[model samples]
Target: MEQTSLNLVAIAVFVMTLSALLSPALNISPFIPAGTTLGILTLATLDSVSWGGRGLTIFLDLFATPQQRQRVIHHEAGHFLAAYCLGIPITSYTLSAWEAFKQGQPGLGGVQFDLTLLSDTKTIQKTPLIIERTLTVLMAGIAAEMMIYDNVEGGEEDKKNLRAIMRIMGISNSLYQQKESWALLQAKNLIIRNQTAYDALIEMMEKRASVEACQSLIQEKINQIEVMT
Candidate 1:
């Protein structure tokens, strides 16, 4: 997200420079038209590039410090770790908004876990345990952000996903909120219990580990944690 934002800014600067240099030769003011066009395109691109883009994602990407990046890492790590602990198969993960954008994901970044094991088809009657696990995993990112920042907005997509799944499961709005709260509590407890493993996985993810390697490492960590406990 940050890189794309910078690229757009660079493009804007280039356009400005070109307009200034060409204005004298063309005997026309191209700055206004060019700026306006680029501004529209930039905003459109930003909208597509991230779920939290409008003001939140863009602000974090461009101006957030190193500590802020760490917060994001922790947030994503929560999802990754929770899914792993609950026996979900992680296909891949990302912490780059641009990468998620290229993949047509709505969120800034996320852990991609396979849900096929839960149900053969989307319309199938999902088991209670599967729904419970899914909800907990869905709320993991929010729980992590709240744990660290004491507040969060980055989990909008997560909440949306949770609600969508609940709707499909025929859960009502009142029940959905209750489930969300319970899921968050479950996620927080799991994340805290598996902090060391989560941190190790986060380190590997930061180094851009492949999906297979991540799966292997996650399983290894889970096994180690189980054995110790």
Candidate 2:
């Protein structure tokens, strides 16, 4: 997500230079844009080839605005809530790339599920339910973004994860699209139906609540909703 943002910055710089937007009023050093572009591209390449972009990821987080951090929190909360509903146990979550580095995810930050179950999930005929749940969990973040923004700005990583898992299950490329579409709908419905619980989860996460506390609070909120309904 941060990488995408940075790449856009580089592109914007080049565009501004070509259009001579920085000619009269912004009479700054020409070396500024050139050096900035070069530096950004270099960091992007190095970050990609090493530590999964952890260095740049952490650097970006330092200057991240409150809204940017909230987006991260909301995105991770979607994953957390989906995993809980699907009975897929999550071990932890990290909202920023730095915390993700501490959690060993580096450039990737989100809910970490106990994915050991995936090793046992084969391409057998009887495992369709398991497969569906896993796909929905994978699409949850994208779904949340869609629900809130009416447009998803992230989820390339989610798509890659889904594709990799599908390949592991011996699913064909053609069916992958159909499966992803279905899972996205399922994830949207899951988050929308449990709005109160989802909002509570986001709040807990924003407060930097522990995994245990978040889960417990979710259970409490869900129980109340269930009883009231």
Best by lDDT: 2
Report per-prediction Cα RMSD to one decimal: 6.6, 3.5
Question: Using TM-score as the measure, which candidate wins?
Answer: 2
The local distance difference test score of model 1 is 0.76
Number of backbone collisions per candidate, in order?
0, 0
In candidate 2, stretches whose alpha carbon ends up further than 4 angstroms from where it belongs are: 1-47, 121-126
Q: Give TM-scores for every candidate, taking all chains together and pairing residue i with residue i.
A: 0.71, 0.81
Q: Write the per-residue lDDT of candidate 1 for residues 123-173, one digit (tens) a residue.
A: 436477888898899999999889878998578778998888888777888
For candidate 2, list the clashing residue pairs, or say none: none
Candidate 2 lDDT over residue span 71-177, tens digit each: 77777788889989898888998888778888788565788888775676453335767777888999999999888877876788889988988887889999988
Candidate 1, poorest ten consecutive residues by summed lDDT? 51-60
- Model 1 per-residue lDDT at 33: 52
Candidate 2 TM-score to native? 0.81
